[model samples]
Target: MLTQTINPTYFIIDFDSTFTKVEGLDELASIALAGHPDRVRIVDQIRDLTEKGMNGEMSFAEGLRRRIELLSANRQHIDILVDFLRTKISDSFQRNKQFLTEYADQIYIISSGFREFIVPIVTEMGVREDHVYANEFLFDNEGTIVGIDEANVLSTDGGKIKLLRTLNLSGDVYVIGDGYTDYELRESGLANRFYAFTENVQRQRVVQVADHVAASLDEFLFHNKINRSQSYPKSRIKVLLLENVHPVAVQAFEEEGFKVEFVKGALDEDELCERIKDVSIIGIRSKTQITRRVLENANKLMAIGAFCIGTNQIDLEAATERGVAVFNAPYSNTRSVVELAIGEMIMLIRNIVPKSNQMHQGVWDKSANGSFEVRGKKLGMIGYGNIGTQLSIVAEALGMEVYFYDVVDKLAIGNARKVRTLEELLQISDVISMHVDGRKENANLIGKREFDMMKDGVIFMNLARGHVVDIKALVEAVKSGKVAGAGVDVFPKEPKTNDEEFVSELRGLDNVILSPHIGGSTEEAQVNIGHFVPSKLLEYMNNGSTYASVNFPEVQLPKLGNSHRLLHIHANVPGVLAKLNSIFANNNINITGQYLKTNESIGYVIVDIAKNYSEEFIKELKEIDGTIRFRMLY
Candidate 1:
C-alpha cells in the first residue's frame, strides 16, 4: 500500500538460534552434560569455533574438529537434546505454521547445525523431511560414541551452495536468519537477499552483511514488499489493511515478506465486518471499528493494530475476551503532548485566543487587563500517567507550582502533590489542568460543580480526554466569567479518520484556547509513533512479550518445561474453558502448565503435555461447541 510494488518470493530460513530460541548444538551440550562443570569450558570453545567457521576465521573442518574434541559428546546427549529443541519454536515462526505447511516446496532449511536435531525441530515447525538440508551425525553400535559425516558439504567450504544445487530451487531465494553460516548463503550468491533477522539476537557481522536487517518478522514481510507468491497459492498469507495506515506503517509490514492489501476509504461497522473475510492481519488507524461481528467474521484475521493512541474506538474488552491482542502507541508522542499543554497554559492565561479572534475579525480589541504572564502560576494536574507526569516536570521548571491528583498512587516525579480529592487541589490552584485519560467512569469528571469549587478567577486547561470535562458547562463557565479562561484541546464528537470532517461546538469563543486535538501532533512525535508502535507489536509477534500492550496480560512467557503442547485462543465466555478441559479429559491427554491469560475479550491458554497426540484432531476441536482457534504444535 505504501509503495505500489509487489513481487513473488520464497524464503530459506536457518535453524539453531534463528528459528528456535537456543542454538541446537549448544542445547546438546547443556542437556548432555548438566552437572559436569568441565564440559562448560568445552561449550564455550565450540561456540567460539562455530563462530569462527561461519566468519571464515577458521576452516569448517578445523572448527568441527576443535568442537568435537571439546565436547567428546555421546549419543545420550542428543536423545535429550532432541526433546529440548522440539519446544523452542519462535513466536513469529510458530504463528506462520499454516504458511510452512502450505509453502513446503519453497521453504527450505539450510544450516551448519546437525540434521539429527535440526530436522526433528523443523518437522515440528511444519517442515517436511525432504525440504531440510544440514550436517549429519554418525552414531556407533554402542550408541555412546559419535562422529559427524565428513561427506556432507556443510562440513566444508561452499557447502550450502552444493546442497542448494541438489534441490534446484526456483524463484527469488531469500535467506533469513542470524549466524555467519547463514550470511555465507548470500555471500556465495546462493540467495537473492540475505535478510539479517535480528528479531531474537543481533550480530554485528551479520547485520553489516545483510541486504536488509529486520528488527522483527513483520518488518521483514513489509520490506520484502511481496504479497503472494504464485508458487504457493493455498499457503500465501493474504494481509488485509483495514482502515488507512501511515505509508511507513504499510512499508514496515511489506518488508517483513508478506503480500499486503490496503483499502484506503473509511467504512462503517457493517462494512468492516464484511471486509475481513480473507485478511490474515487487519491493520487500521483509529477509525475502523473491530467489533464482535468483525472478529467472528474475520475467519483469517490474526492480529489487529489500533494504529493510533487510545483504542476507545474498538471494543477492547471484547477483543481480550476473544483472545486477540490489540497494539497501540503508548509513549510515541510524549514530548508533543507536554509542549502542547505548556502552550495551552500560556495561551489561556495570556488571553491569546481572544486577541487572535479580534485581530482576525479586523477589530483592535487590545485590552491589557485580561492578558497576563504565566511566570508565577499554580498549575494543578489531574492525572500523573506518562503525559501528565511529563507535563509536571515541564510546568515545575517554568516557575509554576504543580499539584497533582491521581486515584492510583503515583510517585510525583518533580515537586507535585498527591491530593486526597479533586476539591482540595481545585480550591488553591490558579490554573487547573485536566490531563486524565479515557476510563469508562471519567465521562464528566469536570463540570459546573467541580468548576464552582475552583478559585474564583482560575483559568482551566484540558489536554487529555475529550469527555473528561463537560464542554458545554465549561463554555458556560467561561462565558459567565466563573472561570477566567479555558483551553480545550479535544472534543467528544471528534472525527474517526483523517478523511472525516471535524466539527466543534466551542467555535468563535473568546479567551478560550481551541486546538484541533494537536496535543500529540509534532513531526518528531509522528515519526517516532510510526516506528515505535509497529516495533513493539512485532516484538510481541516474534516473542510472546506484552511490553507496551494496552489490553492483554503483561508478562514474559518464560522457558517451556519438558513437553510437547497445545495452545488455544478462545472466547472468554462461560463453559468454553470447561469444554476444552472436557475434550482433553475425553482424549486422556495429560496436561502440564496450562497457562490461562486474558484481557477483556479473548483468552490465550497454553497447554503442555508429556506425551504425543495427533495434531490433525486440533482442527476438529476448533469446532468444539465454543472453541475459537485450537493449535497443537509440538
Candidate 2:
C-alpha cells in the first residue's frame, strides 16, 4: 500500500447546489407554500432569485431576503427541506462519506442558507452543529410565521467574508460553494482559495472567477491525493494489444506495473467490443478498428496507443468526447514505407515482375524490349507527407527526377519539385506513386480519369491507403498497355490473416506486383513503434501528461522535484485559475511550479506544490466545481 502524506487543515463547504443538488430556499418555499393559491408563482420567484445569486447577477443578501419573504411556513417546512436535501446529497460526496466523517472536525458549512435546514443535512454527514455557520430563522409563538435573524453576519452580502475574517482561524481556509458570495471569501483575502463547486449547477459567473472549479467533491479529494480508493490500481490496470503490436509495448507496460494482454491478430468488431470492456489502455496496429461500440464498452479505457504511423483505425472523435487520449507513432515507420516504395518503383520501371513470372512459367522469351533504366525517369508522387518526402530524396539519389502533388503546401525536398495539381504530375511523369492518407476524400483518388491523364506505359504504385487508388482502373490501364506495370501493396479489401488466400483484380496480370500490405512491416519499424507508443501511454497514465496525444489537449509537463503534483481537468470556461490559486493561498500551500493547457472543450492544469500539506487541503480542492477529473502525482 502507498503511504499517505497529505493533511488538510480546514474544509469550508457550501449547502445548496454544492453539497446538495437543489437550492434549499426554493425547496423550502415549495413545502411552506404547499397547495397555496400563489404557490407556483412564489416557487418560480424563489428559483429565479436563487439562479440570479448563484450566477452573480444579484447580491446574495437581496436574493436571500426575497426568498425568505416568499416562504409562508415555519419549523415544519425546515424539517421537510432537510429531508429532501438528505436524499439529494451530491453523488461524489455521498460516495466519500467515510472520508468526510473521518475529518468532520475540519469540515465547516458556511452558507447564506438558514441554519434550520443546513444543520440536519450536514450533521447527518457527521458535521457538528458548531462547525456549520449559516443564517438563523426566527419563528412566531404559533411557529406559523418567521423572519430571518438580521443581526447574523450571514444575512447580508459579503457576510461570509466578514464572519471568516472575525474568526481568525489559525489554519488554512478553503472555501467551497457555487455562488458569488462564496467567491467573496477568496476575493477579500479571508480564505486561501475559492473552489467553484458545480456538481449540481454550473454558474458561469462563479466558475469564471473561481480559483478552481471542481465538478464533484470526489474530484477535489482525488486531486489532493486523499480519495483514490475508486481509482484502478496499477497492477490491475489492463492494457490490451491486438494486430501483433510489437512485444516491446507489452514489456514497457509490464515494466510500468500494468497488466498487459497481447493477441496475435486483429479481432472482429464484436470480439473487440467484448475484449475492450475491462481494458484501461489498448494498443493496435492498422487492422483493428476502435469504433463507437468499442469505446462505449471500454468504460475503464484511459488511453489508446496506435503502434503505427496512421491512426485511421481508431475513432478519434468518440475517443476525445469520452476523455480517452489517443497516440500514434507518426514518424517511427516512415523509413520502412519509403524504402518499400523505392524498391517497388525500381521493379515496376524495369518491367521485372512480368519477365520473372514468364521465366517461372517455362516461357523462354528473354527480350529486354520493354525494360528501361530508372535513370532520368520522372517519378511522380501524390500526398507529399513524411513518406513521400523521404521517397523523393531516395529516388533523386537513384537519378530519378521527382515531381509530387499534395492537397497542402509542402516545401520541396532536395531537387524534388512540387507540381501545381495532380493532373500535372500524371501528365508529365513516367511513373506515379501514391502516399495519401485514409481520409474519405482520398477514396479512389486515382481512378479512371487519373489513369487517362497519365503518360502512356507509365509505371504506377500505391503503398498508401488501399482505397486511394482504383484497382480496376489500374488493371485496365495495364491490360491496354497504357501503363507499363503497377505495384500495389494495399487493397480496398484484404484477407484477415496471413494464411488466407489472396485475391485481387490484378492477380493474373503479369505486369503487376502485389504484396500483402507490408509497406511499414519491417522489423526495425515495428520495434521503433513498439518503443515509441507504449512509452507515450505510460507517460500519460503515470504523470497525466498529454504531450503527443492526437486526441486530448496537449501539455508538456516538466519533471517533478520534491513536491507533490496536482492535476486538474475541467470544462474550458472562465475563472478556473483564480479558484485554484485561492485554494493554495488560503491553505498557505506554496506552489513551486504550475503549468496549464487547454482546448475548446477542456482545460488541464498541473501544479507542483510544497510537499508538506494536510488531507483537509485536498478535500477543499475537490470541493471546487466544474472539475471533470483530478489527480495527485507524487
Candidate 3:
C-alpha cells in the first residue's frame, strides 16, 4: 500500500445547500411566513436571492441581508428550521457519519448562514464548536426579531477564502461546497483544490470552474481513499422492487442483510424517479419502465435486476454509461414460455378455441369438420434460441415434424429440419409459431408478404414480442380464411394494468385464442426469476462480478482470500493499466491477483492485494487520468 506525504489538514465545507438538500433560509421563510399576506412573493424573493448568491451574480452579504429581512422570522422559527434541517441532511453524508467523526478535527464548516441552525446539525456529526465558523444572529429581549453579526468574517462575499487564509493551516487544504464562496477558497490559492458538491444542488457556474465534481459525499470519501465501511455497513443498502416482483426477490435481498422495499405495482416516471433517488438497486418486471430520465436521477443506484426474460423495459445503454450494471433472467423463464407455446399450438391445431367459444354461445354444432389430430402435422418454428430449441424437442416427441428457420445458423434438434428460408418453412409446415426478441429490426417481421406465403389451412401463433407481428394483417388473413386458426399470447397495444379494459382487432373472431400475455407469467417462472435475478444483482454488488450483465463488460471474479479487492472502471484508453500498477508499486503494495475486461466504451479492472495496503494507495489509484468510478470490496 502507498502513503501520502501531505494529508489534508483542513476540510472547509459549505453549509446551506451543501450539507442539506434545501436552502436553510428558503425553508425558514416558508415555515415562518406561512399565513402572511405576501408569503408567495417573499418566498420567491428569498429563492431568487439564494440562486443569485450561489451563482456568483450578487455578493453573499447582500443576498443574506435581503433574505433575512424578508423572512420576518422569530427565535421560535429557528427551532423549526433546526428540526427541518436535521431531516434534510445529504443522504450520502449521513451514511458516512463515521468518516466525518474520525476527521472532525480536520473538517471545518465555514458559511454565511447563521449559527442557530448550523450548530445543532453539525454537532450531530461530531463536529466541535470551534470548527464551526458561521455568522450568529442577535435576538431582542422578546425573541421576536433578529439581526446578523456584521463583524463576523463569514458575512462577507469572499469570507471563506479570507477566513481560511488567516488560519495558516500547515498541510494541504481541500474545499467542498456548493456555492461561489466555496469556490473562492481554491481560486484565492488558500486551498489545494475545490470540489463542486452536487448531491443536493448543481450550480453550472461553480461546476464549470471546479477542479473536480463530486456527486455525493461518498464520491469525495472514495476519492480521498477513506474507507466507507468504517461508517456505512452493507446492511444499510436499500433495494426497491416494483410491479409485484415475487416475494422470493425480497427474501433473497433481506437474507443478504439489505433493506428491501417492495411495491405492489408499477410507478410512472415522476413517481419512480423520486423513489429511486436513494435506492441502491431496483427490481422490475415487464410493466415497469426504467427510462433514461430515471437512470439520470438515480445517483445512488448501483445495479438493476430485470426479473423476466427481456430487458427492453430498461435503458441498458444509459445504465452502462453511468456504471450501473443491468442483469436479466435470460434463461430462468425459458421453460415456462416453451410449455405455453406447446400448449397453445395443440389448442390451435385441434380447433379448441372456436369450439369452446361456440359452446359458450349455446351452439350445438359438435361435428369434427375443421378439428384435426397432431399425429403427423408439420410444425414451423422461428428464432431457434432457448425457447425455440426446447420446443423443437417437445414437438418431435408429440409426433410432429418440426421445420425451423432462424437468421443465425443454429443446430437442428432431433428430427427437426432447418429450412433455407422463412418462405420455405411457410410453404411446407401446417402450423407456424414465432419467438423473437424486442429488437427494432423485428418489428412487423411477419407482414402481409410472409402471411400470403402460408398454406390455406395453416394455423398461426405468436407468443413473442407484440410488435413483431402485424395485427391488422393477421386479422385480414383470418377473415379471408387464408389462415384457418390463430392463437396470440401477446399484443402490440396492451393495457397497463390487469384492471384496464383490453381492446383488440381479433376480439370476437371464432377459432382465435387471445391471451393476456401469460406466456411467462406462471408461478414457477416468477419464482425462478425472483431467485435468479436478485442473486446476480447481489453478486455484482458484493463481489464485482458482471458475468451476466446485459450492458457492462463481463467479468467473473473469485472471492479475495484474506485480501482487499479494488474495482476500477475507466474509459478504454492506453496506459491506464500501467498507471494503476505504478500506483501500487510506488506504495510498495504487492498485488495478489488482477483481472481486466474491456469493451469499446469502458475498461473494468479488479485488483486484489494484501490486506496491508495504505489509504494513500486508493488515493493514487483515483488520481489516474481515465478513472470513471472506484470502489473497494473487502
Candidate 4:
C-alpha cells in the first residue's frame, strides 16, 4: 500500500545471483550431474562462464551456450533446481516479500536464465507470469538433452536493452541486478536508474559502471524512499569498533551494511562518551573502559562487544541497566591463556630466568642448586574456570600434581584435587598460579596475609586480573624469598599504549617474568575473539538474542520467520507481561509466540505477532510502566 504513495515506475530485476543467493545454472549442474565424474569440472566451467558474462568479459549468448552444453540437465533436473532455488532466494528479497506481492504489476524479472526456473520462483513471489522475460529451454523428445530457444532476445548479448525497448511504455524504469546486462538498460537510455545488486554476488565491472551499488534489495528500496520490512536501514546503524578490533570483525559488520567507524586505539572516558552517543554498537578490547558515565551518553547503543576474555573493562551493570546487551569471548582465548600460564610456570619453577639473565651478564653461573623439574611438583590453581580447568589438565599432562581451589564447586579434571579454601592450597602447593576474574571484591585477593601462608621460596604467578594481587606485596615477598620467581602478566596500572613508559616496582627484580598483559594475545586468539564477539553482538542486534551476554538474561532465539518481532526490556516488576498482552488484545493483534526471560534487575520480553502494528501501538508499549527500551525487528 505504501508503494501507492511513490511515483509509478517499472522495476526490472535479475534472476540468478541477484534474486537468489546462487547462480541457477551453477547449482543446476551440481544437482543434474550428481554422481557423474565430470560434475565438478562442468560446474566450475558454468560458474566461470557466469562470471565472465556478468563482468562483460564475454558475450552473454556465448556464455549461455557454453553453460547449457555443459549441464546434463533434463525436465526432472529442472524441477529439482526449482525446489533448491526456492530456498536460495536473496535474504533481502526474502524479507521484502510483501513489497513484491503488493507491487507485482509494476515489477518485471528479465534474466538470461531459463523461463522454467525463473517463472516458478518469481510468480510464487507474486510477479505476474507474463512479466517474466527469460530464455526458454528446448528439450529433446526423451527430455534428456536440451538447449535454450535462440530466438528469444534474452539469449543475446544486449538482450535486456532489446527487451526494454520493445516494452517501451514504461515510465522511469529502474534496473536492479548483479550483471553488466542490467546496467545496459540504463546505458541504452531505457532505464532511469541501475542499482548494482550485491546482496548475493558482486562483479567489479558491473559495480564500476552502475549508477548506484546496493548491498541488498532493502538498501535499494530504502534509497528510493519505498517502504520495507526493516524498521530502519542497516546502512543507518552506526557501528563504532574501537581498540583496533580485527579486520574480520570490521568486514563482517561492513558486509551487513553497517556504517563502521574503526578506531585503531582505545579512547578515554570523555572521548568515548562524545563519540558513542550516536553509535548503535560499540566494540572494545581490554584497554578501553565502558564506565557508567560513558554509557550515559550512549543514547542509541544496543550492544557492546568485548573482543577479549574479560568483561571487567566494561560496566556490565550500567550496560544492562540501560537495556544494552554486552557480549564477550569468554572461552575463545582459553587455550592461549592456559598455554601462557604453563610456559611461565615451567620457566619460573626451573629458575630459567635467573640462569638466562646471569649468562647475559657474563656471570656463567650454571649451578643447578635451585633448578628443579616441574615433574611431581604440586601445582595450585586459584580459580577453576575455563582457563583454570584447562591449565589443570595440561599441568597434569606435564607430570605436575594439580590442586585447585574455587569459591564455586567445580568438578576436578584428570587427577586434579579440589581444596575447599585458597589457604589450604597455598600452604601445601609448591607453585601458585592465579586465574580468577576481575570483580571488585577480587581486588587484593592475594595480599601479605595470603603470601605469608605460602611455603617459603614458593613459585608464584598471576595471569588473571591485575587488581586481584597486591603488586607491592608480591614485590616484597619476592625480595624476602618468601615467594620465589614470579610471572606477572597483568598489572594494576598499565600504560594506555605501547609507546608509553612502563614503570613498576618489580621492574628491577631478578628471576621475574613480567609480561604486558599478553596472556591471550596470540594471533590465533585474536582471530577467534574477532569472529566470536562480533557474531554474538550481531545476533543480539538482529534477532534480540542475548545467549551469552554477561549481565543480561540469556535467551537463544530461532531465526525470525514470517512475523514482526518486538523486544521489550523493562524493570523486573510484576504486571509488565499482563499489561503488554492487554495492549495486544485491545488492538486485536494476534500473538504468535512470546518469550520472557529475567535477571535480578530487569526483564527481557520478545513478542512475535502475525502482522504489522500502528505507530500508536509502539507509543503504548513505550508508555508502559517500567519500560527501559523497546525495538521492532523484522
- The better-scoring model by TM-score among 2 and 4 is 4
Kindly list the per-residue Cα lDDT of model 1 for residues 1-634, writing each as its tens digit.
Answer: 2222244356788887678867777667666667886767867877787677655677777777667656655777787888876677765676557567766766788887888778877887678788888888777787753677889988777777778767666667888888777777778776888888775667887789889886555556556543311212212455666555566766766655455787875567787777778776666655566778778887766566766567776777666655566778777888898898788788888888777877888989867877778777888888888888888888889888888888999888868767888899888889988877676689999998998888877898887778888988887887788888888878887776666787765776677778767777777876776687666655554344555667766645544455655667766667767877887787777887677777556566676776555554565568766555554433
Compose the digit string of candidate 2's lDDT tens values, residues 23-84: 88888888888889988998999899888887778788888888878778877777777878
RMSD versus native structure for model 2: 20.5
Q: What is the TM-score of each candidate against the true structure?
A: 0.58, 0.62, 0.64, 0.75
Q: What stretches of model 1 exceed 4 Å from their correct place? A: 1-244, 263-266, 285-287, 359-367, 497-500, 558-566, 570-603, 607-613, 616-627, 632-634
State residue 409's C-alpha deviation in candidate 4, in Å.
5.3
Q: In candidate 3, residue 5 scores what lDDT?
A: 39
Clashing pairs in 3: 1-589
**1 or 3, greater by lDDT:** 3
Best by TM-score: 4
Per-prediction count of colliding residue pairs?
28, 33, 1, 0
In terms of lDDT, the poorest run of 10 residues in model 2 is 1-10
User: Which window of ten consecutive residues has the lowest lDDT sum in model 1?
Assistant: 226-235
Tens digits of per-residue lDDT for model 3 on 91-169? 7678778777888878889887878889999889888878898888877888865778888888877877788888888
Model 4 over residues 184-277: C-alpha lDDT tens digits? 8899998999999987777888999999988888888888877787767787789999877789999989877787999987888999989998
Clashing pairs in 4: none
